[model samples]
Target: MSDDEILMHEIDTQLPVADFSHSSPCSAANRVFVTLSGPNFRINNGFETDDMEKLYSGLSEKRSETKQNEFPLIYLIAPAETTFDQIRSAIRTAAKAGFADIFLVTKRTPASGNYLKHGLLLRLPTASGLSPPSIEPIFVRSDRDGSIFINTGPSQEALDHCREKRSLPKLNETLDNYAACARAGGFEPIAQIHIDSSATYQRAIDVMNAMQRCHIRHITFTDVTSTPHRTCQGMGKGKPGTPTQSPSAIPRPPQIVNPVKR
Candidate 1:
C-alpha cells in the first residue's frame, strides 16, 4: 500500500469517535492541541489559494451553553510556492473560530518569527547544504529562543524511502547533527526531518533516533502530517528571508563575545 493510503487507513481506524462529533461550544476552558489538516490547495511563486469558509467549517465544533475551555492548535501544509498573504488569511479564519495556536509546513521561512503575537507555533528552518556543525549558532539560537521546528529538506528520496522502507541514502549529516544536539539542553531533532515523509511513529524511529528527542520536555517532535493530521491548508507562513524587511531591521548573527585579536 502507498504511504498516504496507510496513513489514511490509520486515521480512519484511530480518529476519535468524538473528533467529528458535535461538542458544546467551548472557550479557553480546556488546554488541547487541536489538529486541522487540509489536502489540496493552489501554490505558486509563494502564494496559496483556498476557500476560507471551507477551511473554517473543517475546524468548527458546535457550542452549547455549558462552555468548556479548548485550546486549538491548527497545523497546515504548504505546497511549493505558497505565499504569505494566503497564510494570513488562513490564520485569520481560524481565529474567527477561536483557535489557540497554529503550526505550519512550508518550503520557506516566514517573513519574521513573529508568531508569538498570534500564538503561532514556531519551527527552526536550517540552511540547506550547510553541515549542522557549521550551523551551531542557529541551533543554539533555536534552543535559547524556545518552541522551534527544524526541518532539513524536501528530499524526494526520503519520501520514497518512507513508502518502501527500502535501503536509501540516509541524511547522514542531518542524522549526526540531531544526535549531537539531542543531548544538549535535552533537545533532540526529528528523524523524519521533512513532513513529506510519512508520519507513522515507527517510520520516524526507524529512520532516526527520535526517542530521546521525543522525551525532551522542552522540545516537540511533530510528525502529525501524512497521518491525516489535521491542518489548515495555507493557514499562514511568512515569506522567506523577510525580503521586504530593510537590512537594518533584519537580525544579525550573534558575535563572538571574546574573539582573540587577529
Candidate 2:
C-alpha cells in the first residue's frame, strides 16, 4: 500500500491520532471530511497528497451539509503542483466555501498572493528558513482578536524545507514550544506544523496526536505549488522583498522608519 493509502486507511484504524478526537475541537464538532472538484477550478486536478495516495483528483464529499454546520469551518487545500491554476483554485475554494478560518499548508506563502483578503496576514517568524515556528510572531499577533485557533496543517513542501535545512525538531518539543508560546501570549495563535515528510505517516500521526494532547482542535492541510511563472508576487500584497532599513539608516527614523521599498 502507498503512503497516502496508509494515511486514509490509518484514519479508520484507531491510531493514536484518531484516539485524540475527543481532545480536538473540530472532531468534537464532528465535521465530515470532504474533497471536491468544480468548473471554477483551473487545472481541475487534486494534489500530491492525493497523487501519492494514488487518489489524484478524486475526492469524497459525501457528508450532508446540514451535518457539517455543527462543526467549525476548516478547509485543507493541497494543490497538486506549484502551478498558478492550482494556486488559484485553492484560494477560490477557501473563499467560496466561506470558511471562517483556513489552514493552508503550502511551501509558498499564501500571503505572497492576494488570495488572502479575508483575514489578517501574519508572516510567521522563523530561525532558519526551516526552523520551528517562533513565539515572537504569535505573541505579537495575539493582541489581535480571534486569537489562537489552528485551522490548518503544513504540507510536504513545508516539511521538505525543514528537512533540507536540517533542523527538524522533535515532534513533542515543537508542540511544547508552541504550547508555551500560546500560553504565555494568553491567546490561541494560528500557525502550521512542518512535520518531516520523509517521516511520512508517522510524522503526520505524531503531529495530529500532539495537537490533540495540546487541545488544538482546529487545523487545515494544503500544499500550494504554482508550477509556473510568477505573474505577481502575492498579487500586489507581497511582503517586503528587502529589509526596509539599512543599519546606517536605522537610528534616524521616528516616523519614516526606513522608507526604502523594494
lDDT of 1 by residue, 1-262 (tens): 1122112112111111001101212244432333222433432123233566654554444211124343334444443233333543554454445453444433223453533232213222121232222122111101111111344335222212333342223443444455568666454232322222223322322222222222211121222444442222212221322111111111222221221110
lDDT for 90 in candidate 2 is 39
lDDT of candidates 1 onward, in order: 0.29, 0.27
What's the TM-score of every candidate structure?
0.27, 0.28
Residues 42-114, candidate 2: write the lDDT tens digits: 1223332323112312222211232433333333333222333343233333322322222332222434564
Backbone clashes for every candidate come to: 22, 21
| All models, RMSD in angstroms | 18.1, 18.9
Residue 67 local lDDT, model 2: 46
